[model samples]
Target: MTMKPYRSMLFVPGHKGAWADKGVNSGTDALILDLEDSVPPVEKVAARDVVAETIDRLTGQGVRPDLWVRVNPEETGLMNGDLEAVVRPGLAGLFLAKIYNETDVVRLDAVLSHIERLRGLDDGHVKLLACFETAEAMGSCEKIVAASGRMVSALGATGPNADAGRSLGIEFTLEGLETLYMRSRVNLALRQIGLIHPMAGVWQDLANLDGLRTFCEDSRRLGYRGLVAIHPSHVAVANEVYGPDPEEVATARRLIAVYNEAEAAGSSAVDFEGQHIDIAHVKTAQALVDLAEAIEAGS
Candidate 1:
């Protein structure tokens, strides 16, 4: 799989057009112009127009960050119109929220394909990322990933943050442990369908750098490729968190060089820096080296 590091997916409120510029300058790999949770209800229409205008201006100004637009949920009357305004060539992808099933994802793909065809652009060229919230959606994670096909690549799941806090009569803090489990389930489900590495979720509290760092490390350990951040200040941390350490890279290179020499000598296993090495060792070393290269390439 081609790795894409969604280390920092910063959210910019749709109404704050100025923040669009500020968001790009913040060095986030991607910015989400949120028409969902970030915008007030009454300002939806105005915000929609503002987001479209801001996107065009950003493109004109050569901002060129990964521009992802988070549309309101399908139940919201604004989804269709919001998408119509924002899904241009300048947009890198769509951050679809409240996706409850495979059908939701398929419908989104169809819509984007239709838009692209109407514009005389190639069909299925747009990228889509779906958010899983409900317990039902969590249960159907494999189906959702399968239904996405080539158009859908990333899957994000929020437990208490989106579902439990709003639905299951649970407190946010009380649901943290469950949220981690929920996230792990989704991550495993995605891997089953070959999307082994994908962006995790928004942690919400941008100022909690310590907590953020801890969570970032946790995500890395949990097989997550990267994470989503809601603030610009968190970008550098995200970028740094999901990569092979310099020491690890050096060790990987050493392992590979020694292993190669041993293999040329017809040895089944080799000793490297007083440590025994075998096929498994070489495989692990190669993976680390690849990760280091990906990080350097800003993947």
Candidate 2:
């Protein structure tokens, strides 16, 4: 599976068909048609069918952002039915909720394999976006991520009063000091395992756009590659905050140029902008530029 850059993933209630189109037009990198939280208990089955039809509609129109489904947890006994309804050609993958350990991921992978074969999709075509909303999941972050090649990214930012907060009993704050340790641990595990773009969870205060921006900026600075936004309004904020700034891109290009010139002159390092730069710095600059270029092309 090709790894797509996900700066922002907007959540659309699976039961609401109109919101899916709005979500796609909201400029998010991807859309998560949620069958778990947003849909009421009585509507879960109907929501699955709605999500399936939405996937077909979006793909038939050749939409931009990828479509993902947030399926019910395995414990619910509704996941199998959810998967059956939404695992189609246009569907990108699943956003697994309430994962506890590697065993959960392994079971999911087995199910995906069977689904792909049944649907005639390529092996591993249905990727996973794992959400660590429980204390056990956070404790076993490394194992969970390493469990499946199908996981595109692992998320550790379950909001306050949600699964993680309830399980861990951590208070939520704007500064995020309470969950800092867990977030840092998850980030480190992802980096160590080579999943560079782990997603931060949703900012629930929908009315406070400024607060949302601050939360996203903080996450970006903390090495999170993107955010999961519940509202369409937060989409642009995530994209901008996670994206390389114009000034940063220009500096990266200039740094690479200076480094190349230095190397041509029989020098492996160069004094550029009052700082000494070597091949390591050049590689970083090149990477930033490459990311910028990719984002531009995708846009």
Candidate 3:
């Protein structure tokens, strides 16, 4: 599946199939059907079929958002069942939950390859999106991410009392300086691997749109191009924060036009609205325009 540089991916509880419609209507860039934490112990087995049906229905209806599944980890002895149920035609990727090291990465890769072939899907048909939520995972993130060619993007996994905070034995803060080092390290690892559009977080506050907006803005400033959201309402906030807004897109187009004109006149740099722009600036502007176009084309 081609990545959309998702601005927001909302997780829908696998057992609550109806909520899937609500998520699609909420304008999220993608849907992560949860067969892990959101599902209860009693519903774990049955929820797999429900999630599979939801994927098939959405795919049949031609839903715009790419569908993903957050499968159970191997420790639970339920991951094999989860993967068997969800890795089909409609699945775009899997959120490699609770990955602790490169060993876990290789194991998951092998499992995915087996399932893909067994189901008549192409080799590497499904992609992996790593989650750095445990201390072991956090410490060896670079190795884990590089362990598989199936990795497309990763989430830094910061949250209040979530696995990340609890595993690292840290408290959460609105300013986020407490977890800044780990988050920053994840960003650096992604950069070294030549991956752009690194993502982070789950706001966890369903009612506080204002606080969620702050989290989104702060994440964008930290070089994260997207975010993991639990609620659909958070989608608009994320899209706005990580946006190549209309004005930015317009300015980029104008800058490209002006720069091209200057080059034709035998100049290397030109003043554009009090800012000196050169080829470097042009490349940045073009990237913004391209992202804007992609977001426009996606659901």
Candidate 4:
């Protein structure tokens, strides 16, 4: 699978033009222009117009970070209009919300396929971020991912969803564990299909800095590429959680250097910091370096 570093996925309201620009400029790996929850009921149409205009402005200005739009769920009044306004050039993918099953994914695939054709783009240029928020979606996450045409870019789920075990009075410790399991399943499915890493979910609180950090760290350990950010303040935490730390980068460089030296001597592994470094360790170290560089370059 082609790796796209989405260490930070910051959500910007579609109606807020200035904030949209700020979000892109924020040190996030990706900016998700949200047309769903961040937007209100009455302002949906205006939000679409604002998002389209912002996209046009960004494209004209040659902004480079991966851009995506979180469309309202299928069957919502704004879903079709969201697609119409958000499917312009330079769009990296779509953040499909409230995906209930594979059928919904298939329908969206067809819709995106049609939209691509109408716009004279490649039939499958636009990818999807399947948001598995419902119990049905959680149960069928693997199948939903498998059925996503062109492969979905990522998978996400929320903590307060009606389907979460937390809804049954389970403590967050257990709930977080469940979330980890669900995210792991989704990640495994995406990997099996050879797709990019999946996102976890939005932490929902902007002021609870500790909560955000713990949640992001949890997601990172669960194998999620990143956590979704509802507030720009959370972007830094998300990026830090997903990207390699300075110490980690330094260690990786050292391991890589030692491994190369050993390979030059016809050895398969090298001892570094009292630990044996093999090809897998070297590859992982290089990946960490790549992720760090991508974050610095904002691409």
TM-score on alpha carbons, each prediction: 0.88, 0.97, 0.97, 0.89
Full-model lDDT for every candidate: 0.75, 0.89, 0.89, 0.78
| Residue 271 miss distance in model 3 (angstroms) | 1.4
lDDT of 3 at 194: 76
Per-residue lDDT of candidate 3, residues 27-104 (tens digit): 888899999999999999999999999999999999988899999989999999999999999899998789989998
lDDT per residue (tens digit) for residues 86-141 in model 2: 99999988898998899999988998899889999998999888888888888898
Which scores higher on lDDT, 2 or 4? 2
Candidate 1 structure quality by residue, lDDT tens digits, 146-260: 7866434454444344663564444555235646766687777777776756776667775888877887887777777777778888888887887678998899998999889
lDDT of 1 at 285: 89
Stretches of candidate 3 exceeding 4 Å from the true structure: none
Which one wins on TM-score? 2
Against the true structure, candidate 1 has what lDDT? 0.75
Candidate 4 ranges beyond 4 A from true positions: 1-3, 161-175
